[model samples]
Target: MAATEQPISYAQDIKPLFREGDRESMSAAFDLWSYDDVVQNSDAILGKLRDGTMPCDGAWPEEQVDLFQRWVDAGMPA
Candidate 1:
């Protein structure tokens, strides 16, 4: 976990997980555009990420996934 106890910000943390083309490519199926959208669908997001079923290319780095989980566990902080 990160040393700082500050809550994760979607803009700072989660949004970066998606790539430059992600919004265009995954638009039809998924949208990681804003905080509310993510917080509302956090369960599905975590599930897919945990199971290595997201990104459509490969699993995220362990640390990245861990960080995301921390965000979720922290009540999906903004």
Candidate 2:
């Protein structure tokens, strides 16, 4: 099966997207590595990713952003 054809889960697909630095940088606001935190702020996070304002350093690539959107669309499975 193709990558997009498979189910997306937080542990396997979503959480790994956030690097250590990312977790640290966003720590003051939220825990990027935490499922609850991510799900709670998904919309705002998606907006930032779409607008190229996340990471506080640089924007994620189009594919990464799209993957994130897909996870959200999938009901943010854990």
Candidate 3:
């Protein structure tokens, strides 16, 4: 984290990245909106995101993926 960089949190940052349909589609696997689930599965999720295999509709923008990676690297905060 840089001096001016704000910390990332699940509620304020990561959770909103998953859409309602995303949560519905991934319900069988895990709840995308759940902090614990996400934290547990963050690595696999990041791999899928990086490879454009998540969301199942289309890949997220590079910036969004980068944001996710940043959150993960930042200790999967909150």
Candidate 4:
């Protein structure tokens, strides 16, 4: 639940959970996450998910939420 506990690779675990490779619904952590303030705020992104403001297309599953949370809880590893 802490940043230090994050897994090393974002592309490996986190990317796969979302539409990263789908192209149609693909979401790059970098695109959603900017180098500025937003990149560091995982909750902001998750809040969108939790409040049904994400994808702008559809909602992610709870399991996907957990995966995203884990990645966020893990410090949004790059």
**What's the TM-score of each model vs. the native?**
0.82, 0.93, 0.93, 0.57
**By the lDDT metric, which is better: model 2 or model 3?**
2
Question: 4 in model 4: Cα distance from truth in Å?
Answer: 17
Compute the lDDT of residue 22 as modeled in candidate 1: 62
lDDT of 1 by residue, 1-78 (tens): 358987787888889887877667667766788677777778888888889888778888888888899988887767
Candidate 2 regions exceeding 4 Å error are none
3 against 4, candidate with superior lDDT: 3
lDDT of each: 0.80, 0.93, 0.91, 0.59
Candidate 4 vs. true structure, TM-score: 0.57
lDDT of 2 by residue, 1-78 (tens): 276579999999999999999999999999999999999999999999999998779999999999999999999999
Evaluated at residue 4, the lDDT of candidate 2 is: 52
Candidate 3, pairs of clashing residues: none
Q: TM-score-based ranking, best first?
A: 2, 3, 1, 4
List model 3 lDDT by residue over 8-69, tens digit each: 88999889999999999998999999999999999989999999998789999998999899
Task: Say which prediction, candidate 1 or candidate 3, comes out ahead on TM-score.
Answer: 3
lDDT by residue (tens digit), candidate 4, 1-78: 344544634666655544543334434443442323334656677897777667677778786777777766666666
